[model samples]
Target: MQVAQATEVRKNWSSFFDQVVHDKPQAVRRNRDTALFLSKTHMEEILSQYRFTLEYEIEEDGYYSGGLKEIDICWSEPSLEELKQTIAKDLVEYAKTYMDNFALYHNAPNRRDHFPYVMHVLMKDNIQEVVELIDADWERT
Candidate 1:
């Protein structure tokens, strides 16, 4: 959880490598404003701990709705809390925005379709569940 400027990281690449070997991840900041991270083993370990599936369905318009279906049961690691928080925040915002937009367009429709309110509500509900799951830290194991 150490923070270093991007320039500092570039200047001390060897030290950063040593830190990674020692299981210490470093956050590199650019222009003292934006931050990036460097942690090879940590990333690999996280990836190894998760499983992913792709789910797709054909829509009425002959297009496909595809999503990454991630199945992971382990979230006990401290680093995962940040990920959970991010997911929760994103879901909450998404749900709110979708509802706002749906309200605006509930009466409008294209020639081929009816009201899209139901679909938007379903999406909002799904996002709400994601937010709740993240907040509860409800992993399978």
Candidate 2:
């Protein structure tokens, strides 16, 4: 990866684009790595090398219990925004079903190591609360 200053990149983006095209990866630094620019082919290859796992717990109405679901995402070189959007879409689908039993099983607060997982049981009648909770967690991640 080639390191380029943010100011330099901003001042001459066409040159930076050419550098990224030739070098494959260029780290744009502004005190820290603000962004990494890469050729489309190179970016896809990098993304294809990793397997991302997303795990979450939800209530099951039939079992009156909680279950952990693990989702494995294999990205074929999508942009960061695209990856986040895909994950958010998948999470919403799973969240809607699991959250139906939220009131049935998790009607009280439980001690969790994670601060955000420590939820207070409030609105028992609405599924919107669960949706909001899931959305909030998604955003945080």
Candidate 3:
């Protein structure tokens, strides 16, 4: 994790590409501004630790209901399979909405911590990958 001056990196930006790929993410600074430049895959790997749980319940009417409470997103469907698909679809929509207004979502008191989870959702190449994150836990009474 090397820290380099922002100007130097900018001046020799081409050389930094290899370093960013081979080495741990580097820190760059310009005056009071400092930030890490990391690969998208690396960022995803790092954020992978922040996972959301999938919860659901069988309603009296036989509808399956619930979703990731951490992000306040949920869905209801007639079957468990449809529920999973709905959950995945809803998650992707939520992620897109969150990213569309990143500053707003990131600044929100309740949603501030949702960044990692939202990123996790967006990282998935498809809905199946996102659906796999959910454990098959269910509440039935």
List the pairs of residues colliding in candidate 3: none
Return whichever of 1 and 3 wins on lDDT: 3
Q: Which stretches of candidate 1 lie over 4 Å from their true place?
A: 53-141
- Model 3 C-alpha lDDT per residue in residues 7-81, reported as the tens digit of each score: 999999988977787776889999998898887779888977876676889998988888875777788899888
Models sorted by lDDT, best on top = 3, 1, 2
Q: Which ten residues in a row have the lowest lDDT in candidate 2?
A: 112-121
**Top TM-score: which candidate number?**
3
Most accurate candidate by lDDT: 3
- What is the lDDT of every predicted structure here? 0.45, 0.44, 0.83
Colliding pairs, model 1: none
